[model samples]
Target: MASAVRDRTAGTTILDALETYLAAPKPRDPGDPSREEFLDLVHATPALRDHFMRMQRNWETTLAHAIAEESGLPDDDLQARALARFALDIGALAQESPDPAHALRTLFARLRNGWTDFPHPGP
Candidate 1:
């Protein structure tokens, strides 16, 4: 049914795809894809790349703030807990995602709408 397909493919948000893309390991077998193939995988997915860039920028900004708050190293280290927060955010976004591809597009749309005063690059 429509609902089932939506449920199966719908939970792939920008952040989810970004993390998956980032954490993907290099192919090990000879039959596996080459480095260029892997790069193409990410490049071909423009929506995913946009999401990754946005998330990376946000994290960098957030981590910078955290660092500024701390006299020493920030508490927001790249630990499981931090990643879990990101995953949860992604899941929430995914729940509203119409499909895997639409997820990032929708996110960008929302972000752009709220930033009328500030200019942002087109996704």
Candidate 2:
């Protein structure tokens, strides 16, 4: 069906954007070199990958629900926006973070707390 094709296309587009955004450099304040240095530290860490993946999944779900409620979009459309927002949210988070480590740490902490509070569903 056309709807299924549209949904697939949208999902692919969003995932591509997220891939590009994640590889981009962190934002910096004009007068602050230390901020860049801190971001470098955060970027250099190998452990942040797991944290990033978890946060991405959570953000995707959050965005889908929020957009659906706000815009009254169809489920498929909302899903597409959720995927697109994955990149946008990461960019926003990078800009807002005081330091790269802090941004990553905040995500990890949130994910940890969420898992702790809710039991995982599985057989």
Worst 10 residues of 1 by lDDT: 1-10
Model 1 CA lDDT for position 37? 75
Cα lDDT tens digits, model 2, 29-49, are 788767446556656876665
> Please, what are the lDDT tens digits per residue for candidate 1 over residues 1-123?
112212334556433444444333435799887645765786789987788678766755553434333324354555433443444355346545556446645544544355556667889
Candidate 1: Cα lDDT at 23: 35
lDDT for model 2, please.
Answer: 0.51
In the predicted model 2, the residue pairs found to clash are: none
lDDT value, residue 76 of candidate 1: 52
Q: For candidate 2, report its TM-score.
A: 0.34
How many clashes in candidate 1?
0
Q: Show pairs that collide, candidate 1.
A: none
C-alpha TM-score for every candidate: 0.27, 0.34
